[model samples]
Target: MILAQILHSLFFIFVSYVLYLKYNNGVVKPSYIYSIVFCGLLLFVFNYFFKGLSNRLFLFLLMFSLSFVILQFMKKFVNVFGNNEELAKRKQLKVNVLSVQDFVFKKLFIGLICFYQLLLIWVPGIFEKMMENQ
Candidate 1:
């Protein structure tokens, strides 16, 4: 179970890095959906060794495939609200400036994933507690 938790943390950390690279100010190649397929399969295979109808694995799966959704929703949020012009202007014609937003977003989202892996967030001990209550 501890190993599972470690694996979960590492996987999401990698994903957070990937997201940062995807959004960082640069010429990104048009992406392929294969990246998503690859990540999901990788996550499933590592966690498959544990046998359970419901457990932290189920929660992590929701985090990866559902709750997170790669945070693509941020595009709409950024569009409707607006870009961080203060951050944008700070770049000042230099190329390859590090995006503080992407960096923070990486930490924020990935930090939650790691935190939830450790604490289980809203679903903390949910199944185990239910089993005990019976």
Candidate 2:
């Protein structure tokens, strides 16, 4: 079980870093450090709760695949929205094209993802306690 937890934590960190890098296209900004902090906290919480789950290997594989797919979908969606807006603005200005150079959007997106992961690890515990009280 300890070994399984360790493996799962390592894999989770790896996948998260991969997703962040893919979204930023290998660009490492200062904001990406949140990924490390969130991953660390997530691993600690996951290992504490790890013993309850059976078939850790299978679940880890499933989670990794799902996260990758979700990240790809979100990236595509952001690209479409950003591209469309840029195109509209450029057309109005009668310009050929303009590339997205804003780092704010990517940073905000990554920060939200990190926040969501923290909530995922926390909110269930909160709800479980509430259920016990009732």
Candidate 3:
């Protein structure tokens, strides 16, 4: 289970990095990278810290914390990219928008990876008991 968790974390980190690179291309500023990485690490820590907590209240808190970190990252991403209208316009002209097929495929790929990790976390004894016949 520990190994599975480690692998899942690594997979998520890798996918997130890839997503960042795809969105930013080669023009991402260094400060933005630092901010994004910091936010990502915070999310990771929050996730692992709350993994064993089963109380609804604590779970809600953790979820909120995680969401906050992700929002911070998104804010930085938008501030760095979206605010640069000239750069964004130039990039848009040079690069094709991701095709619907490509977008859907990437979404499915990431979703499956996340779902598989969730299954690994819940299998055998963890969440299985919740579904057992009474």
Candidate 4:
């Protein structure tokens, strides 16, 4: 189960990284990848440390909210060390932007990443318990 969870988290991180790279015109910045992995590890640790909540619904809600909070902090941390060249490039590229499309795609990717992280942490036990109850 631990190995499965790790693999699942890695898969989401890879997919999210790929999506980010694609949208960023193939700019493979190490910071983005690191931040994504760091966020995933953080999520995994959080899930592991707090797995004893009796209320499954509350656990779900907590993980969902925690993902957003953690992601937001990660974004802020990355932005604090933003590269000057990247900032310049972004300014230049603003004229050729697809804001709405990119915005929607980015949000969808983030949502998937969060959802998968939660699933990785909870799905096995949650489903097993549900099946036993039935």
Could you tell me how far off, in angstroms, the CA of residue 31 lies in candidate 3 after the best superposition? 11
Model 1 spans > 4 angstroms off: 26-43, 52-74, 83-114, 121-134
Q: Write the per-residue lDDT of candidate 1 for residues 17-123, one digit (tens) a residue.
A: 55555555434344434655565566576556553223455454456634454475654565521355664676643223434444555457655654554454235
Each model's C-alpha lDDT? 0.51, 0.50, 0.47, 0.54
Model 3 accuracy (lDDT, Cα): 0.47
Encode model 3's per-residue lDDT on 21-122: one tens digit a residue: 544344555766576566455555655675532333223323433443475466556644345566566775424333443444344444454454455444
Stronger candidate by lDDT (2 vs 3): 2
lDDT, candidate 1, at 76: 50
The candidate with the higher TM-score, 1 or 2, is: 1
What is the C-alpha RMSD, rounded to one decimal, of candidate 3?
14.2
Candidate number achieving the greatest TM-score relative to the actual structure = 1
lDDT of 4 by residue, 1-134 (tens): 46545644564555455555655568766776676567556655655675532334334434554464466557656643244565457774553344543564456646665675557355667645764797
Clashing pairs in 1: none
- The TM-score-based order of candidates, best leading, equals 1, 2, 4, 3
**TM, every model:** 0.45, 0.38, 0.27, 0.33
